[model samples]
Target: MKVIKSNGEIEDFRADKLINSLIRSGASIEEAQEITNIIQLKITKPTPTRTIYRLAKNLLKRTNISSSMKYSLKKAMMRLGPSGYPFERFFAKIMQAYGFETEVDIVEEGRCINHEIDVLAFNKNTVVSVECKYHSSAFRASDAKVAMYVYSRFKDLEDKLKKKYHKKRYEGWLVTNTRLTIDAIKFSRCYSFKAMGWRYPEDGGLEKLIEKKKLYPITVLSIKQDSLQKLLKHELVMATDIIRISNEFLENLGLNQRKINQLKKQARALLG
Candidate 1:
């Protein structure tokens, strides 16, 4: 269920949990299951996510997929905990990189309820909301339930905001790691709901970015058992260290400030 890192730090992970992560990352049920099976059958290492990264790289090459999808897939594989907050933050960053003014882990209030939208963005007359998943398969009933709940709430809020602030109606984006459920995908396409992970460019700009090494995907398993135990027993092992490491990697690779900030926010949220 759990795996160790190269530094001998232990972290607990369950197969079911990984399945959920995969679903959140936008994988289909079948894809998530297959990836889970492969990990269980072939991974005997301190860092299974690392193995997952290699496997995914091979998949991208063979499938000729886009870098954007690959990025999301790698994130699902390396996710350390149950909360989908990290991936939400990643979506926040990608939006910023694409030129939206963004907020991570936003709390929106309307009609006497406090709604926590994963990401919120604004650009001139446009306001947008995003919900992120890092799953390995298609969305489930629960996913639809939550999405409908939030979207319905925001629907009212959108009207209120438009009337009060004279701003444009808000756009809702459901960004998942894997693909959407059939119904969800249908709803998105018909209703202006934006989905990620479809279509590899024929020229494949995203694929080329990945293949040329402009974008590097690093997969990290949780801390090892002994290290986790020590930390639980009062020894210190700050997960924020991963933030520092990720920052170094991004900066070294010349990731834009927007991207760095997004990753930094995710690291802080996860470590805290």
Candidate 2:
């Protein structure tokens, strides 16, 4: 039976539409098909968003296999590898979901110069600087380097903004795929800063804050089925297919033009 729209049911799954979405997102037909197969197998329950989220996560991994069936899809994803700006995009989604007026890739003035904050939030008289990270494993001590850099940059940015807009209150936030380091956690607690990680909500640590609506927790992948339904209707993607082909096509045209110029030069020489 077809799922109905009013009852929050998923419409018929169309492999062709899924394939086209993947292609639009830059996946080849073969890769898109493989991802589709994996998604079909994994999404056994009735959730569309989790299906897309899981599919996106798995497809971003690098596959290593000599044969078609036994590849190890466990390698680390490089920066901006898939979903280009995935973490920033994810953080932006969370902020919007929570009713914050937000801007992605916002520039703020630091002590020395202008720095870019990944996501900037404005709520009444308050301004918030947000940093987002998506990784395969827990955050490391070294990863704090990025946190510090963002902090340093944002100081300048915030000062600049205060002057530019004459604001007196501002805040900061850091969002990561994994939980915070012990040191980072301690630092935030002492400073009254806001930070959120994947493990934070699972441990019931966020229940009070979430209940009070003081913190915006990342909504569970399981609960965002509506998001998935919306995603399915929106489009599918491979992450890198179209851009690669377009780049190659442009390069080939440039090469052909060069070769044609060489041929013309030789023809003129022969005529002389």
Candidate 3:
């Protein structure tokens, strides 16, 4: 059977690939193989990759809830925004957790024009200007145009920094919640700009970075949508934010002790 990829391309379905993905999401090898077998039986026609993902998620939910939660990380990220602004804040928090001093939505005068940086991160040795591409749709990808634009903006800033701030070197990074187009990846590599997306770069993609840092968004917990929205409205985005919130505050929001404790447990698991 053929499967439609997230990029809208068609390819032959590979059961092994699906199994491997489940395994990466913390499923046991036996469970992964079992899920793949069931998926193969259920496929009647050309299926979208999203459908396959949903199927796997449902199966994982029945067998292993923890793995299902891990697999749904990207969906949680998508839930973070109707606009990209909230995602920028979440991204800055993630960077901060990793020991980088970060600033969001800062405007700086470049050599040619003033540039609005999405996230500016600096340690002692290096400064990075990040262009955060947040897409609500999982299938949509950041394209070469985005890469080119960010590269130009970073170049402008880098040139100015070299002339004035000669101590620290500047670099460009384009980060996305979904994925990048082939041309975007190629252009980034050719130009030496760091381009990272959901699964791009293989080892150091956004998902890998989040897992490595244990910096999960609060949306990953199994909570009611309205309650989650309330938390988001209060600017509580990360799972770690739950630690600071009082149980009484959650009770005032209509959560009982049982539900509140469950949410905290999920947050702790994701954070750890």
lDDT of 3 by residue, 1-272 (tens): 88998778999999988998899788999999999999999898989998998999999989987778888888999988877877888888888877789989999889899999999988777787889999998878999999999999988898876665567788888999998999999999999999999987898888888888677788778877788778777778888888779999888878889999998887776555
- Clash count, predicted structure 3: 0
For every candidate structure, what is the RMSD over all alpha carbons to the true structure, in angstroms?
Answer: 13.0, 17.5, 2.8
Candidate 3 stretches greater than 4 Å from native: 1-12, 41-49, 162-165, 251-258
lDDT of 1 by residue, 1-272 (tens): 56764456767545676665555444566766666676667756556555555564444333332322444534433342234654555455456555788877767766666677788887877788776655633332224554565466666566655665575656777665544456665555565555443222224322232333222222222334443333223212223333545455545545556755765554443323
Per-model TM-score versus the true fold: 0.48, 0.44, 0.86
lDDT of each: 0.51, 0.48, 0.86
- Candidate 1 overall lDDT versus native: 0.51
lDDT of 2 by residue, 211-251 (tens): 23322211211112343223222221111111223333423
Error of 1 at 24 (Å): 22
Ranking by TM-score: 3, 1, 2
Total clashing pairs in model 2: 12
Task: Say which prediction, candidate 1 or candidate 2, comes out ahead on lDDT.
Answer: 1
Candidates 1 and 3: which is better by TM-score?
A: 3
C-alpha displacement of 194 in model 2, angstroms? 1.8
Off by over 4 Å in 2: 1-84, 138-143, 201-272
lDDT of 2 at 56: 44
